[model samples]
Target: MASPVDTPRNSPSPSPEPDNPYPVETVLTVPKFKRGWAKGARMAFFEARVPDYTSARAKGPAQTADYLVAVSNAYCQQFTWWLDPPNEPTASDLAKTDDELDPAELQLKAAKILRLRRASRNLLDRLSNSAPAISKMTPAQIKRDPVSSLISAIANGKTHVPRARTAYQLWSKSQFNKDIKTDVDQSVIDNGVDAKSGRIRLVTGSTQQAFQNLPASERRVWELQADAEKAANQEARGLQKKDGVIPAMPLDPTATQDMLDALVHKIDPLLQGISKLTNGNAHFYWAGPEPRRGGQINVISMHAGVDRMPIPCGFMEAGGSEGVARRRTVEAAIGDFALSCYDPKVQAARTLPKIAPCSAPPSFLRYRPTTWDAGNTESPSAHSQPSTDNGLISPPDVSLPGNPTTSSNQSPSATTSKKSSKKRKSNTDAAAPPAKRHATGVRTNTNDEDQTSDDEPEETPWQVDDDGSGEDEPANSQPRRSGTRTSMRISTKTLPPQHDPLDDITNTVHMSSSDKLPSPEIPDNVAGAQLTDDDTMNEGLDTLNAPTTPATASTPVSTAPFLSNPTIPADLPKYLTHVLPKFETLAEPAWQDVTKSFVKYEVSRKFDDVRLQTGNRPAAAVQWSRLRRPLITPDKLPREMPQTVKLAAEAFWRWWRHLQPSWRNVNASANALGDIDRNITEEDWERLDASGANGLVNVMGYLWLWGMKVGVSGEGCQDWEAALRDVQWALEKMTAATNV
Candidate 1:
């Protein structure tokens, strides 16, 4: 079975459209820079696009360059300034007037054309610099060659070539294609020479012969140009034009390596440290919503992996948002992005966070509250005062919310008398049973009045032994609080609902009532076996009434009973060795079962029809749910299920899915190692748990179902052929179960 990851080395070539021999021209539209602040960058970019062009390679060497001159004239004539200069009325007579032109739009159009022309000049210059043969010629000599003009026009965006009709198509995979092979044979190409004109003219010849006439240096230049165009076309496939980012004003191509280094350090201080730590180079890069004028420019740490990948430090800049403000915003966003990468649960939405104004600290710098209880410490605040027997502190008398205000006419003596009376009432209420007062949700002694002083204990303190023993002793033998707080009656209606359908179906564990209770403390007297018979009986009764503790999730469960018994023979089957690795890894009985299951799945598959039924997904899902329920439900799981079995089962299930055939054979479709369909993308896999693809169950639930049937040790056991066969059988079973 071929997975989606298996892509064809050579994709089918698109059929060619009818060719137009004549020159085709269309109106070119230029867009205006809507942003006011990016005007400086825009102008700089346009200036960089203007070229100092020469016609060295455009004309013949001695008679001078008529063809080269014509090509240059044609290139310049496309722009408005060349056709209709503002300074000359004669030049403007045929051109669009000011009323017909948009100033911003016209300016942008000129800049774009200038940039494209400059790009072509740079390409030629680079080729000349690299080849000594070409370098020896002067700019004038090179520009006189007709080949240079045509190549430049293409790079400058003045001309376009359909990719399907490119000359390179005649060269690639030439060994496998006769047409491409014949196209490159120079001897075969010379047969078409026109005797009288001394010009080459051929019929039924390869497209590559058109370029074979050029000098070696010039031919190499055309090859490089075509290669670049081909690469751009490949990269643009399956992507929309809007997806691309036009980088902020590009750095000067003439800048020295050292200058770039200096620029990087100036922009980001953190990258300097990162470079030293990683023992790799650091450079500036950009990542944002887009690579246009307002896109973020940040320093990325480039360290060597199998290949180099930039590890960016959070830093960014936009138009008019440079210097300190951009750095801070980038830092904040990068912090969260880095931390999220470290988290195992943070797999959703892998796109980088967008930069914006931010005051929040990065993850590493953010304030985090310590969860440790301060009251447990040996500090003075922890044990300031001794607690009372009733667990109530009789506070100093204070005016209650219900009390009437003292009149202004009253003297200080009268106010003092009222406070004294309130104190007496508070003391009386404190003496009453705690159960009665707690039920009323009210206190006679006000909260402010009950505040303990710095010298008093707030909570009961444990006693340290005077003899310097390391252990703590019970403090003053105070009776400990125990049992459920039953005094206050809780309405059933007020309590949140207990039965959640998701939790029940997914087999999620919830804390039982007893699990929520505080563990009962054993008194020092009980440790010494000083409990009376009645005390022993009461303790036994409490233990009996307590809810059972749920099984520990980490503890390994054996899977022998659930799986078919392994068949361990004197000579083990080759497939068994592949899946199990070492025979000793599984017990004799378990190995037998592993062998048996493999045999069962393989032999049974031959009789089963393996037709794919994509539209019957609902029926397959229903059958899958029924099959998986026993393995997933905690109570119904086999007692012998072990961790090893679970891992092996998971690997097996994933391997099976990867073997499933693709439904659609598009360029973007490739199967993943564990995907049931070729359509699932990396993004879909990340959110598989959240998506209800399997109807009622999630990925975890499905894994758990298979996991309970088999277990093993180490990473995971795999049998490529076995898994493939199992998938074939599974598809058949699924179809039968669906009655399709």
Candidate 2:
């Protein structure tokens, strides 16, 4: 017997779409300055859209290069020539008119700064006034949930790709898809997708929850239903029996590495990241809302589970609001544009405690708050940067409106934990000591410093422990793991129901009622995680059943190039096995099936049926949510660096080798595992529980974490809160399966 799957688990309990979109989130307002700003950068990234970028069009990419460099410089300087002191007028200082410079010299920076300025008045604006409600996401969910990372096949190639399609059926298995055999893990994939939700669910909690949700917990005796269905689903290659091609099972992963490379890397990046498709304006590599402030000059396109590119922003010109028309004129001439919703810099700047106008900081604070807290430590009056509670280990809110948690309100579903840290010392720099200490465990260091003060008791006095500030709201709770998400167009509908969905714009954890209450003190890098490898990387799952790899040997992902690039992206939290907590690895026999009878794996639609009020999302977001996991087909771990992605693959193998209890890991759908629990009987459940669930949830956590780091953030994949939430959800599902 198998388990149940083939759709999102335990969701679709509808009330009205929660009207209030904006949720409360921690906002770190920083004063940009010269030296220490970049440490915990003050930069704000916006998932926004802008209109005409004619000025930038006049400049173009070739011409945009020189200006882009100038913008980076201008922000750092205080110039009287410009209306604002912080605004660097150096780029334009070189030329009185746009034509004075060589068209070939233009860079994206100049255009990015100039274009976004045209959209905004001042660089320092508070874009996201309210925090948006966002739940944690698994790597799989982020990759598959593309409501914003939409890019269309530009017929004319002049304007931005239009949003022609809305919904797509995404597979949950795609996120952790390690095997590169190409054909969608026909058996495994079919296990999760639901033709109705346009999403695939393989090993899900929905069915189990159906029984678990009964008012009488004792009444919930689980049964093995979906697992057999999936076993039947995985019965054949492509799983095409007399039914012709099944609606759920699609023959995927057939394309050569070359085709994938072309589509995943070249085309996707250029179209969304560097392309001038959106009226010469910049667009996010993935998808989301518009900027709260300054606009985007460069286009960013991101793919799930893989790669990312950085996004740059510029300050709005003084009296920017009044000069909107003129700004557009200039932007259009030079082809400069800003990203939507990013204008938060503008809003935040306005709200930020005005320090000496001369002492502003640099931008990196948007993604990392540790530095922001450091800054506050140095400045007694650090109003710009706010406070957070680090003691509680609150997880992202996974409960959607209709889907009451298993215990209902009896137990809060999520628990918050401090950021995970590798056992190794800070490889980047020495951590700051805690400034003050409390018996209850509260500590504070400067939130305005170059480095975050470690509050971990074991560290030092300079460290500051924080209880994350952001909290999820009741109405528009971030979309839960098992539910569908909604996205609307910005040009026309950007401001429809409310503001951004995430409450705190920056990354921070939220504590819940049920979470283990922390002492007054909390520290950074506290998740004492460990890594265990599966023996199969060097040994064997089966010589015949090996993993797959990219076919085109021409291009390989090199460690050298990645390390050299200042922007070398780290694989998401998944690969960061150094810090995983309570993790006992799940293993598999080395998949020896090198039979790369490649199938072109496009994110197949489970329900080729109608996509309606059913959580219709933007195509851009859908595109960004799907991560590509090319199967590894290697020999004795290639002695030399290959042309394709090497380091990540190597690290993956090394980690695989560390599995604690070598598992002949089957690519079993979640449903199958559930059946093993159910049919086995209560005694079996008890035995399995005692023997250990192998920390399956922990495995999912690492995978989700790795996924986030892989892509340049803002590519719709690097939401830390989402990653944490997904891990918790996975844990709950796994725990339930083991107990039943």
When superposed on Cα atoms, how far off is each prediction in RMSD?
31.2, 33.6
Candidate 1 lDDT over 532-650, as tens digits, reads 11111111222212212211111112322323234322222212211222122234343344434433433333323222211111112222322222112322333223234433353
Best candidate (score: lDDT)? 1
Lowest summed lDDT window (length 10), candidate 1: 523-532
Off by over 4 Å in 1: 1-289, 292-303, 306-740
Tens-digit lDDT string for candidate 2 (403-439)? 1222211111011112221112222223553232222
lDDT at 374, model 2: 33
Native-to-model Cα distance after best TM-score fit, residue 28 in candidate 2, in Å:
74
The TM-scores, one per candidate, come to 0.16, 0.15
Q: Relative to the true structure, how large is the alpha-carbon lDDT of every model?
A: 0.28, 0.23
